[model samples]
Target: MAYPIIFLLFLSLPFSSAKLNLDYYKATCPDFENIVKENVFIKQTAVSATAPGLLRLFFNDCITDGCDASILIASSAYNRHPERDANPNLSLSGDAFDIISKIKNNLELVCPGVVSCSDIVAQATRDLVKMVGGPYYKVRLGRKDSKVSDAKRVDVNLPTTKMTMDQIIEKFTAKKFTIREMVALNGAHTIGFTHCKEFSDRIYPKVDVTMHPKLAAGLRRVCQNYTVDTSMVAFNDMSSPNTFDNAYYKNILKGLGLMTSDYLLSVDPRTRPIVEEYAKDQQAFFVDFAKAMEKVSVLGVKTGNKGEVRNRCDQFNNNIPE
Candidate 1:
C-alpha cells in the first residue's frame, strides 16, 4: 500500500508542478473585426477596410523559424521596405502599424502579460484571411522574437514577385515547403493588390498576349496611362478573384495567372499536378492551404519569454532600449 501510494503521489506531483495559463490564442480570438472597425487607417483607404497587410507579414515571417515573430521588424533599414529608390512607402506602412496596435491592445485587455507578440501576429494573420474572403487558419500561440535583424537575411529569404518556378521551389524548400505548398499558399494572392512597379517589366518587354489578354490590357492601361503608374490589380487566379477558394488553380489551368511566380506554379512539371487537382476541387485547396500555412508559420521561432511582447508589431519593444 505504501508503494502504490508513493507512485500515485509521484504521478500527481508532475501534473501539479506544471503551469497552465490561458492567453488570446488559448481562448477564442478576441473581436478582431471590431478592433479593425475602430482603426483610422482601415477607414482611410478606399479599399483598405480589410487588413490583409497583416496577413502578408504573418506569412512572410512564418516561412522561417516556425513563425519567430521577429519577421515584423526591418531586417535592417536596407531590407526593410521601399526596396527601390522610387517607392517611398515600400518597406513599412502605417497600415500594418495600425492593425498590429489593435491586436496588442485587445490581447492586453484580455490576457495582459500572458500573450506573445509573435502569437498575436500569427492570430492576426489567421483572422485577416477571413477579412479578405479567404479560409481561416489555425494559429498556435507562444512564439518568441529574435534580437537579430539583418536586411540581407530578409532579402535572401523573401520570394520576389519575379521568381521563376525553380527559384520559388528553392526558396520554399529552404523553408520546408514543397511545390504543392507553394502554389496553394499563393492562393493568398486572391485578394491582395500589387503596384505596377512590381510587375510592369513582365508586361512591357515581353507581353504574352496569348494569355490573360484582358488582364494584360488592364495592366497596360494602369501601368502606362496612370501617372501613379501604380494602378491596383486584382490577385487570385481569375474566376473567383475575391473568394479564397481553389479558383486560383483553375486560373492557372486557363493560363490567366497574373504574376510570374504565380504562373510558374502550374507550368512547372513539379507543381502542375497539384495545381490541376486544386483547380478541380475547392475543398481540397482549402485543406491543403491550411496545412501549408501552418507549416510556414512555425519556421525558426522562439516562444514564451524568449523575447519581449511588443507594444507595436512594426518595431520591437522600444522600452527595452535597443
Candidate 2:
C-alpha cells in the first residue's frame, strides 16, 4: 500500500504541457540561465523532492498563460521570496546545479547566445527523465522566461508535499489530462525521496494502517540518519525508478504505493479500474503515459509569433533599452 500510494502520487500527480516551430520560440522568450538558476536552487533544497513537482508547476504556468517571464518573478517581497527561497526541504542538493552547469558550459562554448535558458529548463527536465529511465517525450522548447512569479499562484498551482487523490485529480483534469494520465504520471515518483515531514502523517497518527507495520518501523530505523526534519523514504517502483514505465502500475497492484495519492488508486473509482488494467500490462501504461505527456508538453508555447526564443534561459531581451 505504501508503495502504491507513492506510485500514484509520484506518477499520477507530478507534471503536465505542448508544440511549435523554431521561429515562434525566439520571438517570445526569456534568458535560459535564470531558469536554470531557479531550477538549480529548487532542486538543491529540502524541497528537492519537489523537483518533479516544480517542473509541473512551470509547465502548467507556461501553458495556461503565454510564457510570460513575469510568471516566475516576484510581485512583492515576502519573507522568502519566490526568487530567493529554495523549497525548505531539498535545498542546495547540487544534483540539478551540477547538471545545469554542465549544460550551460557546453551551450556557452557551442551555441553561445543562441539557445534559451527557458528551453534549458525544459531540456534539463527531459535529460533527468531520460537518466531516470522514463520515456523521452519531446519538449517543444522555446519557452520564454516568465517575469511574473506569483506566490499565491504557487500555492494554488503546485501540489503540496502532502496531497489527496481528489486534489491530484482536480489539478490534472484542469489541464485536459485524463484520469489514466494521472495514474501514469505517478510513476515518476519511482526515483525520488520523500521527507518525513511530508509522509510522517502515515506513521505518527496511524491513518491508513494497511501498510506494512514494519514499513513505518523500518522508516524510523533510518529516518534519524537522514535530515532531522526528513525521512529518506524511497519510492516503491524502484526497478525503473528513474525511467518512466508501467512498472509503477504493477507496483500499485501489489500494494506498493508510498503516499496518500499513491495508495488511493485502488479505492478511487475513476482511477481504480484503470490501475487494475495497467497493473496487468506495462505497455498500456507506457502508451497512455506518452499520450498524456504529449498533451502536457505543448501547453503554452509561442508557435505563431507570440514570443521569442530566449538566447539565455534566464534573461529576456538582451538588447532592451535599459
* Top-scoring candidate (TM-score): 1
Worst 10 residues of 1 by lDDT: 13-22
lDDT of 2 by residue, 1-322 (tens): 3577756644653232223433433443344544444444445343443345444433544444434332333223222344212253133233443454455555666456556445565666664554444565665554545433333444454455367788877877776767878777665565555555555666664535755555556655645455554435554554554345667666655555666677787678888898888778767766776676655655544432345444443333442311
The lDDT for every candidate, in the order shown, is 0.60, 0.53
Model 1: per-residue Cα lDDT over 140-183, one tens digit each: 55565554444435566777778677787788888767777887
Candidate 2 regions off by >4 Å?
Answer: 1-19, 22-80, 83-93, 205-207, 224-233, 236-243, 302-322
TM-score of 1: 0.75
RMSD of 2: 9.9
Which segments of candidate 1 are over 4 A away from where they belong? 1-51, 64-66, 74-94, 109-111, 131-133, 225-239, 318-322
Number of the top lDDT candidate: 1
How many pairs collide in each candidate, listed in order? 18, 94
